[model samples]
Target: MSYQDPAIHRYGQVIGLTIAAFVAADLLWLPFSNITVDSSNGVAVIIAGLIAGGYWLAGAVCSRMARRSRLSKVWGAIAAAFENIAIFLLAFIPMSVASCLFMYLASSTARPRLDAYLVDADKALGFDWPSALAYANSFPMAAAVLVFCYAALTWQIPIVVLWHACVNGRRRLLEFCAVLFASSVLTAITMAAVPVDGPYLYFKPAASLYDHFTNAGLSHATTVEALRSGPFIFLISKTVGITCFPSFHTTLGIVITYALRRTPFFFPVAIVNALMIVSTVPEGGHYLVDVIAGGLVAVAAIVGVRRLADHGRRIRTALLPSE
Candidate 1:
């Protein structure tokens, strides 16, 4: 509902979180000279700060307005929640960059060798697969996946966040966060385990999107190499490594689709996202096998999150009893 001093509490939280995130980032960067020295890293920090600050400011303004207008508590909560979600999403940029650095460092020990094995397996699989299902062979199927992937990154999260804010419902917000967290964890693991140079770096004569990968600054191997070279080099490399085996791009799309399934307009959005995921094979330089694996991971993450939420609800119900 509407709080009397909304701006006071909310703005304080915003400022505190911003300062903490900055301090934490700086502290984390201290040991890594490359990351600390990299200009891109600095830019990333600034961008993250600005984004967080903007959302915080927006939320403060919205809260003040809501208080004055005596807006419904549900609407106010939705606004606040969205405000936080935007900040969180924006914060992901720096976090993701940091994660890549961490990924490289972790892989340096025994992961490189392990990755070599994965690469070999990917090569053995080959990219070519005959059309088994007629639907699978359609061009429209590929186009749909491409659109879905693009929208998920560009649109879905924002839409979901807004919906959560408008609905002011904890369940949807928690679901959204769970999906994102699960996807991120799964992606990090997959990238670590199956770090391929993608079709471009690993395969020759670059067919389809593989050519784009070859020409792009960051294929999968480039990311690993960037890690080896240090954060500065990695930052400068510009090209995100193309780990094709389990396309997080596709996986995230699936996660978003599932997360928004209960919301209005979700079905159409989900369909678009599903298509975009399918398109990853051609548009994202992934193999059919990679898409399948990514899909399965998304499914597992969704199921796990649902079960976790259910368990949490049960616990809450038991504790609260009937109100």
Candidate 2:
């Protein structure tokens, strides 16, 4: 028997509804911000949309034509995987673009910088940001490892999706995906309200401090300032990571590890992801408080998604009652 998880559809709806709201928001806010989304981004989204649609169509056709033959079975499995990929791409790609827009729009509000309080909180916790950066920069191999792990988040997502699609781990895949959206929303809930300058810019760490350590956070300062100040202009194709309070990188570290658990990728990936959080503190220029909050947000998002799925099941049972 073929088993399908109900939560897959439910979580898909979470993304669908979220993207709809985001699009509606863009319509409402773009006029006020005087922002122009780069044409290249639209072109990319169109191409991605076509590819997603093609994958879905191929999946449908393959499923219908799949026969008992060995080749057909192999093609069927591949098509099924493609179908899962299509599902993720359809929801996630839009979510990604929309969320980026949301970040900029949130920044336009020009909230007061929270770097002082964040740094103060770090001091209160007896953590020294400069000392940590110096320590990280002192080791070349370890710094390289941190750089690799920090960069791993971008690639790790698709790999997890592919793993689950191949293994028919649909529920796990959707749950992880839901956790992603949930964490993003949870972290960005106070974006405009709790704007932060981040530790690297706030501390103004000396040039010599990060020679060996690649501080990825320094790269986005230009774009962040562009949005925060007047004349908010951004090229969508060139959008960078902007959130700091609840670092999305930190959130992904936890959720990615959670998704890959019990698999061969778990130990190595988890070790890297563990180090990824450490990397975020120095490389991403996040305060110790940001890391702590991000960890809490990730755990909350994961647990919250499970509860939402359960609540959805209960609602469905009450309505259908026939199943």
Task: Report lDDT (CA) for all predictions.
Answer: 0.56, 0.81
Cα displacement (Å) at residue 210, model 2: 1.2
Model 1 vs. true fold: TM:
0.67
What is residue 97's positional error in candidate 1, in angstroms?
3.7
Task: Compare the candidates by TM-score and give the number of the best one.
Answer: 2
What is the per-residue lDDT of model 1 for residues 1-323, given as tens digits with 9 covering 90 to 100?
Answer: 23223332333333344334444644665474443345666786677778777777777777777777757575467557757666556645555555555444434433343334544555587635222112333455444445445545667777777776566543455455555555555665666666555543444432442322223213455455655565444452363544555776778777777767767867887777766766565556565667777888888877766665566556655777575
lDDT of 2 by residue, 92-157 (tens): 888888888888877666657878888888899999999999998899899888888888888999
User: CA shift at 192, candidate 2, in angstroms?
Assistant: 2.5
Show where candidate 1 strays beyond 4 Å: 1-43, 70-82, 90-94, 104-152, 206-241, 321-323
Which 10-residue window of candidate 2 scores lowest in summed lDDT? 1-10
**What TM-score does each of the candidates earn?**
0.67, 0.91
Tell me the spans in candidate 2 whose CA falls farther than 4 Å from its real position: 1-4, 68-70, 314-323
